[model samples]
Target: MRIESESAKNQWVTAAFECMLDGGLRNIRIEALARALGVTKGSFYHHFANRAELVRAAVERWELEGTDAIIALANREGAPAERLHRLLGVIAGSSAQQGRGELMLFLEASDEGVGDAVARVTGRRIAYVAQLLEEHGVPSGLAQRRAVMAVAEYHGARVIAAGTDSLPVDERVLDVGDAIRFLETTLLAP
Candidate 1:
């Protein structure tokens, strides 16, 4: 595709992602996205062959924004502990809507491309965490184990945060903050 069309394609991908966040993966039909974008389905066809292709693109965009971008932001800090702090801080700040949207994406990941992208992003995130732990003087094997636990904790927090609307916002934030602090201390301890 031409550069202009590539930009248009990105618009479709972004719009689809927003729709998924507002609703779920089932909301990403070409007609729905086109209507949401104030474009035509013809425009979607120009970018994607089908809804599955658009879904794959949306998943890639999610991986980029949700994982790769966070890693880059965290890497700006010099010390490993500082990076972990920055990483957790950023992740914790994401809205509950985003956490729920991510859960929905994972739950709806039936397409081959979507599943592969999810797996790749998950592994990459764990590996990045493991590297950070090792940089903090954690043993290689132990760091890997801790990294898995850390990722699991982060996801678990997301799940809880997404489901805790009945609680007051401040209390929910405090609860998540407590969990993050505990994870940091555990991962950084000698």
Candidate 2:
């Protein structure tokens, strides 16, 4: 594989993402991607050593744009409780955009070569959420547990919403709020 300009590499990464969005990561083939971009497989090889490398880059891009960036925005100059709400809202909005079915697809695909990259990003995201919870007066250990629970709830809600098409964004917000309240009252309270 030969080196290419960063813009060309980014374009390949973007093409890979579109392929994933269309049919999960398995559908992302060098040949297909090249065909989609009106380029040759040689062009893809110039940018990525192999499919794994491309998958890793695509997953890294998703994590940076989707999870880490949203959490950062949520934490910007806000009260602890407000920040938590904003963070939950960000999850809710993303879930709504993804729809429940797509979330399952994403989670399944994350377990592939892309999974490690996703896990790394998710770990950082969880740590950030835990820190925010600690700042809001939760104990450090409990904050960490709550952050994990929050991620679980987000995934669970996506599943639930997918099963029931009628589940609204407001309902998802309420579910997240109730979960936060439970954590506060049951775990965080003295």
Worst 10 residues of 1 by lDDT: 164-173
Give each model a TM-score: 0.88, 0.74
How would you encode candidate 2's per-residue C-alpha lDDT over 62-161 as one tens digit per residue? 7776777887888787787778777766765554445432464466664665556656766887787788889878889988988798676666666665
Off by over 4 Å in 2: 1-6, 95-111, 163-190
CA lDDT of each prediction against the hidden true structure? 0.81, 0.69
Evaluated with TM-score, which candidate comes out highest?
1
Total backbone collisions, model 1: 0
Task: Report clash pairs, candidate 2.
Answer: 110-115
True lDDT of residue 189, candidate 2: 51
